[model samples]
Target: MWHDKSVAFRLVRKKDVQETGELEAQARVDRRTKNLTKRLQPGNIAVINHSDIDRVSAEALVECKPRAVLNAAKSTSGRYPNLGPGILETAGIPLIDDLGPEIMDIREGDILHIEDARVYRGDELIAEGTVQTEETIAASQEAARAGMSVQLKAFATNTMEYVEREQDLIFDGVGVPDVKTNFEGRHVLVVVRGYRYKEDLAALRPYIREYKPIMIGVDGGADAILEEGFQLDMIVGDMDSVSDKALTSGAEIIVHAYRDGRAPGRKRVQDLGVEHVVFPVTGTSEDVAMLLADDKGAQLIVAVGTHNTLIEFLDKGRSGMASTFLTRLAIGGKLIDAKGVSQLYRSRISNWQIFFLVVAGCVAIVAALAATATGHALFGLISTWFGDIVHWFATLF
Candidate 1:
């Protein structure tokens, strides 16, 4: 049956996005959902995660750039981000948020139409009006808020698991030899999230002319190292907000734990089938990474994007980064902050030195040219061409 609807167009269902918040907010989504979103290409239809018209503006809605957004979320019409009609009004893409099970009834390739929040086939109206104008936005917001809380709770739950594992590690300890190894043997670039990690890396590049260090990314710092085209040697974090690509990267994984002694990343490691080590303690992943390397006998530790002040720790949403402070104390002698080193070791070539180098180069070139046969001929040719000009100038004088 078909209904008297206007916004009907024919297109194939491209990708099935069960959730939209993950991609938009850069938050964690289920593995299957994550895979689906990554696989979603351009010109594909997307299902809306939530229908909150008021929370998001119409301009923000257009940014999703979908052919048409199917709102699976409940929200009020007055809400800014969820107002489908206003969003589609200028963008020209159809808005279909509140159609009930009728949405499932439509085949993936079947042509459909929408008019005044109603769906139709050809001439028959399939379904009319599903989303409420005022309540949908509030409902969607509540759902999102609830979902975020659950995620946070999950993180907390894993923290407890990390603590138990730390106890075992403390009692058991690593067996065999504890012989330390020199870090100079390996490329060990300490990765930090600094105010100027990019600038520091550029300045320190000269030192890399001789020996490059193995890049170690701490948590989200993995993204920073990847941008530099270097393979991450190791990643230390609690598995929150980091991309899956970073986790599955060839880098060795180390999970940082809370002082309650928990290693929360073990499950993710097992799920991804990656080899990992658990270093449970009260510190950020960056701190644990340094400890692991230093204890293993690294000759030098280079840090980038590291928080060096009490205020820096606070900004990172940490109650206390004391563990980081202490760990640095234990290895400060060999530890070098990449940013600090860059500032101190930057090449200070003076203008006079540059001038001398240029002059020396010119003199060497002239000395060599003066003895060459071709040079003599070239000079003779130049002299003859200039002699006429000089004679003319003398006559004029």
Candidate 2:
């Protein structure tokens, strides 16, 4: 069934052999895009196993400025309309798709040459894959759009199933753990490592400064908070994608564990000698962050970089966003998206503007004084005093 579906949307070639210009670069291979990004240097080929590469991962890859990308998995599985491949292709990064598991056979730091959609090691052809061009990507995207109705139906069905199973989250707010971070009657900013989180955070600088909300970062979102020059009050997640630096950033850590009480990330935090608390829950870390804030009586919950749309949920490749959907329903009027807030909220007055206003006011006062008769008398007295001071200085010299 999978084979038939893949075959239906397979790239149709004009010619069997298209001229792919010879390109030589060192290869950095990893099944995980996040881990690979740290090792990727400019001009090196990034080999990854990410399927339906999400926007955030693609943005991270693009920042490294790699010569090309070689994938062991499909960049777009026609599951949903993911923008990752388009982002890479638009940035002029050649994405070689589904080179098969054999592509992983190439060791790290190996020098490689790409020619005509084939990878070579020292003049020997090691692997071959489909070279994703703009045309092929556009076609795949169009097909994905056409398939959305089907995907949405499946998503809705799954969401309903999960909602039936997890009604406690909506009604009773079960599994919400107590933490030291206070949210009572105060604004709480819950950040997730999703679509344009950085831009959204940048836009919320004024809100963050004025309100001084309790800052909560979920996984890599903690790193995002630190990158924006803010201190995190709490870091909640499975702790997979967050950096060691962020973990040690003195923020209180809350590890999200499975319902069976198995916390895989707890050991890492322990190894780092950092103090942390374990919150066993079934849903995602972002879901837990919102639930935690909401349950603790947060006046308002401002979310940054959270996945709210159907396309984003589909890009995550989940059966359904049941926990997120229910969590939002539970929170109700308390939650506000950062994207909307960032657009609507503006800084009342900047420091520079206030400084200029003060200077302008002073200048106007000086001008007014200079035009008055009393001002002339004052100036004459000031000049006499200045002359006496000058004479005194000369006499001393």
Best of the candidates, TM-score: 2
TM-score of 1: 0.45
lDDT of model 1, residue 353: 95
The Cα local distance difference test for each model comes to 0.55, 0.83
lDDT of candidate 1 over 196-275, digit per residue (tens): 66667667666665667767787767866777666677787887645678888787777766655566777878898987
Model 2, range 26-120, lDDT digits (tens) per residue?
89999989889987998899999889988888988999999789998889988788999988877878889888998888899888877657887
User: Which residues of candidate 1, in runs, are more than 4 Å off?
Assistant: 1-187, 259-262, 340-376, 379-397
RMSD of every candidate to native, in Å, equals 13.7, 7.7
Best by lDDT: 2
Cα miss at 90, model 1 (Å)? 33
Which residue runs of candidate 2 sit more than 4 Å off their true CA positions?
A: 1-22, 340-397
Q: What is the lDDT of residue 340 in candidate 1?
A: 59
